[model samples]
Target: MNIAQSYEKPRWSADLCSCGDTGTCCITCLLPCITFGQIAEVVDEGGSSCVLHGCIYGALMVIQCHCLYSCLYRGKLRAKYRLPSEPCNDYCIHCCCEPCALCQEHAELKNRGLDPSKGWIGPPNAPPPMPPSMIK
Candidate 1:
């Protein structure tokens, strides 16, 4: 069988409102930039800094259409996780419901075993390291 065929189809861990993560929901609702930044940093695997991303998101929110920028990350997250383009396309989804999109992304990472609030989880396949005493 093909390697790709061996894997099951990807699905969102939680529904938009059924997220069950009230804290995240509240945070996203109140301060979307903070939530978006955390989600972006985790999604980017620390390749991008959360503060920088948050600042840019905030700036775009002030100066122009930040949804356009956020939708790009939604696309990136979907691609990275092989998630289905369900409900709607990234652009439409973000434009129509920015807070919901951010919440979903946050829940996606949390369900995938990565906590955005805590930052990147590193490579999935990386080897575990020795304890501090074992290190040189």
Candidate 2:
């Protein structure tokens, strides 16, 4: 199936609040690189390794604004998911509230049935697996 044809209207899963998921909030608060890495891996369709992305994010944090780097993924995610650029533009949102933006993205992935911790959900066009009895 054509990827563009499968696109659904974008919508956020949860509001920007660390309070929504204590574990995610805590982890993100302490080590945003981990969260960002997971999101990047999923967003990139596992084309990049989580460790590599996380390290890059950490390095960016030291020398420059990592939010800028992360915001790029936000755009990719939005495009892939056909989500709207609501509240504000990706750059401004990340620049102003890095953690919240990260959390929101993470939540969005979870809501979409893609667990960032587990990595890519596979090709969006792939057919569902056949039931065991139905398979030859």
Candidate 3:
């Protein structure tokens, strides 16, 4: 079997409700655009600007379907890290508790040493992101 198929994904470093970073949680609750934009910038590897994506997220909120957009990014993050759909699916999580999902995703990035606040500091020569794995 291929390594990808056999690899055991790591559990999210933070819980949906156990939000440890109150600052982020507040930002997510009050200004989700900022949080989502930050996350998108990193996830896209800076292919897109935070302001751009955040603005899009804010716009989608107007139609009350921002969850549609945000959930796609959640999918991207899960694909990148091989994360499981926990407690529920991405769309449901964002639809039911957008702020919580945003906070959890932000926490996930921080836990992986990729602080979204830094704004895509992925240097060209930096080591590639390491997926969770066993030492042996």
Candidate 4:
């Protein structure tokens, strides 16, 4: 059947408040953490408007203050300039939590006086190179 014929007596329409297109939960869940520009860009990318409760993304934003402390207190990935190491990232920004060779090398080099920007482990201006995607 053609698209129009299939929808002749549709269960829902985009105009309906309950319809998927008008969903606002993603924005609602990420409300306090994400900036306006970030939210707009994520929506523009066709991300689903529904956010699962207890999902990692939502959790990360929810306890941002605590996570920041945890990353510093537990992960111990902090800058040397501060006496009490400040949290570099809490939400796995730049895949900080994931296994990244560049980050590992950077961590090692951070002990030395050599600047990461002047090293071959990573590009002068880049944080680290992300791994390639795998096919199913």
Off by over 4 Å in 3: 1-7, 123-136
Ranking by lDDT: 3, 1, 2, 4
For candidate 1, give the lDDT of residue 84. Answer: 88
Residue-by-residue lDDT tens digits, candidate 2, 92-118: 988888889888899888888777877
TM values, all candidates: 0.84, 0.80, 0.84, 0.17
**RMSD score of candidate 3 (Å):** 8.3
> What is candidate 3's lDDT per residue for 13-100, written digit by digit as tens?
8888876688998898889999999999999988999999999999999999899999999999999988889899999999998998
Report clash pairs, candidate 1. Answer: none
Q: Count the backbone clashes (under 3 Å) in each candidate.
A: 0, 1, 0, 0
Point out the worst 10-residue segment of candidate 3 by lDDT. 127-136
Using alpha carbons, what is the TM-score of model 2? 0.80
Worst 10 residues of 4 by lDDT: 12-21
CA-only RMSD, every prediction:
3.3, 6.0, 8.3, 21.9
Whole-model Cα lDDT of every candidate shown, in order: 0.87, 0.86, 0.90, 0.30
* Candidate 1 deviant stretches above 4 angstroms: 1-8, 124-136
Residue 119 in candidate 4 has what lDDT? 26
Scored against the true structure, residue 47 in model 3 reaches a CA lDDT of 98
Model 4: per-residue Cα lDDT over 3-54, one tens digit each: 8896564221111122121123233233422222222222222232223211
